[model samples]
Target: MKDLLIKNGDLVFTGTDFRLVKGSEQLRQNVESILKTSEGEYVLDEDLGLNRENILGKGFDEELARTDIVEAIGQEQRIEEVSQIDFEKNGRELKINLKMIEMDEEELELEVDLDA
Candidate 1:
């Protein structure tokens, strides 16, 4: 029952090859409209709604950015696979496995495997 409201949020596509895309930061700010748009825009569809009883799993990226402290300390952390997010694109369902390393509340830095 946690409600997350992202204001002026930037969405990224975490693909197998670590391919990133500017996902609809240019689209309307109204979150409802954005969610209803096609997956080509990289927005999660209706089935992915926060209250839809279909949110597979969730995690927090507490310290979203790589800071000097983190580098200095070299804290050992692993990118755990949270869940596979599937969305419709061109009449086909595409799956993207989400992996996250919890940071703080600054920004959400999703872990992308460069060596896919």
Candidate 2:
């Protein structure tokens, strides 16, 4: 899959031309987008993204959070399996570490932080 490259919430450009993201990089971007979005926020696909309202709170339940995050990440079609997932919470910030295998056996190690 190929998509317009985005960096820091903006499209990438070089020499007045936009760049494209493909393969693993594209998958990574998708996963990151999924993680950062709140459930029901995407107009076209309300099913996509994590349930931020439930996932973020003073009472942080690791198990439930893990399940929800895994479920959200699974929405990406390129992912074949989810491996290790670890979490660290600091005040209102959430840090997530994940390892997953893609459909073509490509591995992805990602770190996602949520400050919502």
Candidate 3:
């Protein structure tokens, strides 16, 4: 798959055109988008993203958050399985680091940050 690259929630422009990404980069970006978006935010796919209430609130359950992460990513067809997943929180910021193994054995290392 190919897509216009987005950085910091904005489309990337290079001179008179936009930056593009494909293959692993595209996959990485897609996953990042999934992780960053709050569930129910996208109208067409109301269940497409992570549930922020689970991972970002006062009574946060790590396991439930993990389940939310897995379930959301499962909707993505390109991923075979997630090998490793970790979460670190500092104050109101959450950092998610994961290693995904694709169907063709291509390994992807993705890190996503969200304000908790």
Candidate 4:
């Protein structure tokens, strides 16, 4: 693994309520800080919600949803809707559709469609 070299395509998260920017050192700093306080694996979606996992295959779950209120309730509906957002590395395909959900929440769904 140490001998492996790779390239990471830029990941940009944009939405009506929140944006997890890419190529910003400031954002990287913030992310690093948050990761320090976090346990397990996590992924940032278009709505900037952090998905965390205790084990490897726990799957993505909304840990925090974007909201105007820091201490708000029932406002998870404020995020932009996401119908289908998928990414497959071995299959080399990416598809996204934002019109699936009724709510305005953003969904950054990423998946790997690998073949055995």
Task: Please tell me which predicted candidate would have the highest TM-score against the true structure.
Answer: 3
What would the per-residue lDDT of candidate 3 be over residues 20-49, giving only the tens digit for each residue? 999999999999999888899999999888
Which clashing pairs does model 4 show? 79-104, 79-105, 79-106, 80-104, 80-105, 80-106, 81-104, 81-105
**Residue pairs that clash (backbone atoms under 3 angstroms), model 2:** none
Best-fitting candidate, scored by lDDT:
3
lDDT of 2 at 49: 93
TM-score of 4: 0.20
- Quantify all predictions' global Cα lDDT against the true fold: 0.26, 0.88, 0.88, 0.27
lDDT per residue (tens digit) for residues 68-103 in model 1: 113211221221222222232222222222222322
List pairs with backbone clashes in candidate 1: 61-103, 62-102, 62-103, 62-104, 63-103, 63-104
Compute each candidate's TM-score over C-alphas: 0.17, 0.92, 0.95, 0.20
Q: TM-score ranking from best to worst?
A: 3, 2, 4, 1
Query: Candidate 2: how large is its RMSD?
Result: 1.2
Question: What local lDDT score does residue 9 receive in model 4, on the 0 to 100 scale?
Answer: 28
**Which residue segments of model 1 deviate by more than 4 Å?**
1-91, 104-116
lDDT of 4: 0.27
Q: Residue 48 of model 4: what lDDT? A: 40
Q: Could you tell me which 10 consecutive residues in candidate 2 have the lowest summed lDDT?
A: 51-60
All candidates: CA RMSD (Å) = 17.7, 1.2, 1.0, 13.4
lDDT of 3 at 20: 98
